[model samples]
Target: MAQKLKKNTAIALGNFLSQFKAEGNTKNPDVLNNNLFYDDFTDLIALSQSHNGWFTPEQVYFAIRSWAEALTEANLNEWLSRYDFSNVQPKTVGLILAGNIPLVGFHDFLSVLISGHKVMVKLSSNDQKLLPFLAKYMISVQPELEESITFVEGKLENFDAVIATGSNNTARYFEYYFKDKPSIIRKNRNSVAVLDGNETKEDLIDLGEDIFRYFGLGCRNVSKLFVPKGYDFKLFFEAIYQYGDIIQYEKYANNYDYNKAVFLMSLFPLLDNEFLTLKEDTSYASPISSVFYEFYDDLENVKERLKNDEEMIQCVVSNNLIENSIPFGQTQQPKLWDYADNVDTLTFLNKI
Candidate 1:
């Protein structure tokens, strides 16, 4: 089974990579307008957008390859070594995926697959095509996985365990519906940045990726920032505005215009642009909200506030402040070693 999974993953990854040069080169303007998985051209655009700017076809090809490499048996074995799954066997696991970002629920899917369990995946309508396409490729490589994988469009029942991701509102529904089952029902989480006022313009530009990637739709996108008192907003805005082309999305432009108006009406100060909005706020979560910045007079005092809101926070983006934080641009591109909410995913799978 391990060998089959490895071979299949490799073949599927190769198939995806081959499509890039062939389908990605067609220059149809209409094809550039839709979301990923609707078509090959749109999928290319989505990949480029998620990367914070334009990505070369080769770069997109390599990124998909990297994801497949992580699914190999050797990699899976190394990841699972930290957890004791010897006696744990789950018959069925239900997965409710969030489609806010591309392939955001993939890790959970991989966890269920490599842990020797059957998966009943309920994909988000927004991202219905990619998972199934990838699954079909996998099955093409290793036909045995066909029996273990099932894609459903409606409610799932009789699963031994569940792993669901959604907004804070949907969490209540998940809690009530899956209360009797062993589950991990995730709520909303926002990432933040702590700037020490010593950062270079280059650092701020990279930090922009954490802020504006996918037009700030992903949970990993940094919505709020903590800067030293008297930090200059001018330099920050200048650095991030290089990726102004993202505003070309009509939906994103409408969001920016709407949010800008709301802030102005409320007498809130703002930094305007075709793509992003910068404002001042205390909260970390931004929903079509601008790149809000808050000044911290004392670093320790800010740390105390962050500790209080850890549940609402995902990761802290900084240079080298502490153990839990990552580098500025590394927010959207999470390493396999970085587990969600610091939960031991393999252990969670084993317990089921």
Candidate 2:
């Protein structure tokens, strides 16, 4: 029964997602105007920015299209096929979501439900609207799901386990609070890129998406770079120059101006490309509108360093320079199975 419900639910989600494709002007006839979801979706795209300044229509649409591609029956089945659910007992799993990016916590919501558990979600205030709207659509498609999904506004209670994502500070609070419960508490982590100075212009341009998408708010965004000594920034800066218009956004421009001023006041040298700034630093988490970089003498030593610091890194992007690193452009486009912090939520849920 759980398998059937989840499979049908994936189809329903896919159908709903099919309406937002970039290459097509088509809407699913079955999902007519009377359903009110389509109209609401249109309104979401229009109002997302008003709700959260960073939730621009383009970012929201990209998120929608990415989910649409992920929710297909084949992908869902392939992801779920590895798990054994016959002995599972349904438990209420509580979620404390992060609002760094649109629908960032949707995967956790999906994991709880598809694993035959009830989900009680505490939506991040910055991203409160869209997921619940989609949850309504899912419930409409599968009435059984209504009993399995709950959105909580206050304290998360009456749950067997918890999954929470937040910064290093909030994580400390979560850990002490939920210490008694079986929980997955995610703390601050950042992604980095390794460059050998031989990358083509197209590769560097694509790498811009890894840096600037969602305005660099996501953990998957490449916040740092590892470059060889004396690596020239000319071609790399030229390639990413196309994204210079990003400075036009007030919030981003404000950050750029503020962070640049802070750096200059400290007398730190920087490589400025008008829109994005590159600073020489060893940290993994860089502020918005800036990417910190470190010089590496040997790829072997850097790989070992990353291995030792794996907990602080979410992903590594490169042209296969390091084994297991993600591609240059695809950091944010994670597969459903690419669990954050390398924690397997499904396996954890099944165990509990």
Candidate 3:
């Protein structure tokens, strides 16, 4: 398929995606093939939570909206312009996707197809529906692309290269299994926020979005905090109190009750406000409904610590305290260029 056709098809898919929102599904008659896909996609959004209890309509809508925003013509052109697709040799690329978040592995799917490669995907059982449905829509837009995409039910084979995402244990297996192939193997990583005493109440409130979105299941969710010594929690708690309604969700409430009980039984001191818990710990990965925090006496030391621990960290949200730190509440909203684990997916695709 021509590169222009692929890009145009993605833009049309984006238009198709834009109609399904948390507020309601709007069928735009102008969008291509909407008559065929619009109702089905809307029903999928409504039924997603049944497949995975965490896949609520609101969370699924947010993921779809993010993709719709990313697949615009300008964004696609700017992202693709940096690479030379000329003289590209088409190869089959295998993908083993992760299912922690809604559409978590779509970027890899998009990367393989956009880079002029055939993709044989082994979908995570937890996220089996959304991407394959989108793939069908893409094929509808450009029939030529139907041959370039395949969803495998069992083990993947006949691939020149592979990309896989999983937990740390699964990553070990992936590394051993695909060691000979040119690959990008992503393991566990967690995002953290660095805090100073001077941040406004609004800033802390916005940080709530970073913590609670997707029920804190995604690698990009802020799971830890680096706070200055002697900082008070009163203001921070008050700022984030607006998001306490999240605890009302059945799954989140169950997690909150269970995790809080476990922590209490373990005799770990925690600061709680009914919905979320804050514990002082050194670990970056936190349990659902909880956030681990560490105190630092100096800013310079925090920068050194983050730099040395960059591999275990996905994103560092800060108020410009560190160089290249992401702004507040933007960890989940990664730009096309903001590749996962700081490894450029396009660069990997362009080479393989």
Candidate 4:
């Protein structure tokens, strides 16, 4: 397979994805095969939440828009340019995808093919529809892609390598099973934000988006906060109040009520803003509708701790407080080059 063909196909796929946005779906007259695929995609967006309660049209649109923004010709070229794909001997890469958020496995699927390999994908039950649809659309753009993509319903076999993502427990199983093959087994990781009491209300509001987008389902969502020792809750609560309507959603309301009850039952003191709860906890992972927080006395200590616990973190949000940290509200809008878990997927695929 010529890598350029795959890259151009990806750029075309990006254009197709770009049509569906949070504002609304607007068919691009220039895109290929709108007659066949556009209406079906819109229907999928409208009904996604019925199949999976968390997949509200807004969230699905957000996921599609993220990929749309990412697969531009310029962005794809920059991300793929660092590696040499000239002599890549194609291999079949088996993928065990996770469904935590919409199209969570797309990067892996894209990596396998764009690096001159075939992919056999096993879709997560929660997210089975979106990727396959796009795969078909891409194949429509270029007939050659039909031979390179496969979706498996049974045990994954006939592949030289595998990539799997799941909880820590599943990671163990993936390790033991794929031990014979060169593989990348990903486990759970969460994002966190560090606050220095100087962040403006605008910054905190954007941080609210980082926290509430996707109902806090994505690994990129900020689930914990590191705040200065004397930080006040007044501004933080006020800034995030825009998302208060999130409690109106039944699923999120249930989580808010349940998690709050559990915290109260455990006698843990919490700072509540009615819709969201803030608990003083050291752990990085926080339940839905609740964000765990730790008070820090020194910025350097927080930095050192994050360095030591790097494996457990996916993204760190700070306004230049931490080196290499992502800016507030932009976690969900990661660039094409931003590899998940900081594992360079493209490089790994090239080597295999």
Candidate 5:
């Protein structure tokens, strides 16, 4: 079964890499175009807008490819060689995918398959398209894997282990139902950036991707910024203004306008562009508030405070001031080695 899984992984990697060449023929000029699941990508911009916010289809395609390549035979074999999965059964794992962002559940899906476990995935209604499409393509590439993957529309029971992702509110329900089972239940988490006064204009512009990508919906998206007391917000705002075209979406524009009006009614101060709203807040989960940044006087003091607020912070974006942090734009592009919640996912699955 391990050898078979390795063959399936290799085939899946080949199918995914083929997409890079296919992208040229699938171009559209409209930014607000829709990218349906089964069809070739059209209206790249619109397809991106349909997700959470506006990101180019090229960006989304490359991101997916990056993830797929990480699951290749070479990498998987190296990881498995170091870990013992001899006692792990091949048909006892169930994965409940999160639909908050495009292909958000791919990592969990890949983890289960490469670790010698059958995955019964419950697709999020909001994102029912992409994963199944990829699954179909994968099965085509390696017909033997057809028996290992199943996409179910209803509840699953008697699984030896489960990995579920949900809001902090739904996390309680997951805990109650899967308590006796070996599980990885993920609650809410948000990403943040730590900015010092020394950041270049280019750095701030790149930082914009962390905040505005997918309209700040993904867990990796930066919903808040921690800036030094004397830091200038204008420079930061100007740097990201190139993405102003995202407001062309009537829905996104409506959100920006509505949030701006609410702030005005409440006499709250803010900075605005055609597509995004910026405010001063400590919260990392912003509903309609596109970009919320807060000022801090000291970096050391803020780091200490963050330790107490770890649940709210996922990745910290910084250039030089914060040690052991990712760069301004690298938050969404996690390496294969970086596990969610710092958990050893393969080991956890092996134990189950």
Candidate 6:
């Protein structure tokens, strides 16, 4: 039964996701032909904001498109090729999803299914609709998945292993509770960028996408920066002006105003461009609509610091300054194999 999981099924799922990428209420012709799925998608777009204020139609569509691009037959095969599932036994894998960004847990869902494991999903209240709807689509494409998926509401039990994602505090509880089970307990992590002052204006513009997308809510977003001493901010600010419209959203505007006031009250100097604020702080987890920056005289020292604090960091964004750092505008656009925290989920499932 496990080997019956076919690559064509993955491609069909990708094609289904591709239909919802267009911005606004428009639907692809193929999607419109499926009456039930089309109705569900339209309702998803309409009610997403009410479910989670950050889940605007645009952001949800962005998430859908990203998954659509990743789930192609070639991408799926490439990602799965690294793992040998020849001896995978069907065990139930429990998932505790996060709701920081729209469909944030879809990657885990996809990983479990493709690896030939039954998944018991406990979705975050903030992100309830999208994944389950897609799960229905998956069952429609491959009926075998219908018997392997379950969504729990109260407590997570009756599973062989666990893969839980939560904050550092909740992680402690997960560690204690799942002590007897083979598990992957994820904790809080944030991404940072290294700037050498030699980057082009275009690079800075793309970097803005890394910061503002998802309203700086996802773990992959660059919430901190490492800039050389005396780096000029004039060009960076000018290039990121296109995202200034973010302040128009009331939720983002409120957060920006509140965080900016807090900075001013603490007598901290900041570089503000009306919408986004940059403060000289050493912390990696900055609030919404703001990014924390620290000055560095030596790139090597910064690299050493990042190495020492690797667990606290998610992805590194740089223009060839930091080794293996993600390219600008690509922190959020991770490939199918870019496992979170660099922990291979497929291998974990195989062993469990």
Q: Give TM per candidate.
A: 0.84, 0.97, 0.99, 0.99, 0.86, 0.96
TM-score of 4: 0.99
lDDT of 6 by residue, 103-125 (tens): 89988887888788899999999
Evaluate candidate 3 by giving its C-alpha RMSD to the native, one decimal: 0.8
Each prediction's whole-model lDDT (CA): 0.72, 0.90, 0.93, 0.93, 0.72, 0.89
* Full-model lDDT, candidate 3: 0.93
Question: Lowest lDDT 10-mer window, candidate 2?
Answer: 25-34
Deviation from native of the Cα of residue 257 in model 3, angstroms:
1.5
**Residues 1-352, model 1: lDDT tens digits:** 4634643454444434333442444333342122343375346445654443323333344445446445555655566667654575647899999877656787787678767788899998666655676666556556788877888888897688999999899999999999999899899999999998788889899998888776687777899999999887778778887978767666677888898888889998776765777777887887663777799899888789889998998889998764468887878766565777777676788877
lDDT of 5: 0.72
**Candidate 6, run of 10 with poorest lDDT:** 24-33
Using TM-score as the yardstick, the better of models 1 and 6 is 6
Worst 10 residues of 3 by lDDT: 18-27
Off by over 4 Å in 4: none
* Candidate number that wins on TM-score, 2 or 6: 2
How many Å off is the CA of 218 in candidate 3?
0.6
For model 2 the TM-score comes to: 0.97
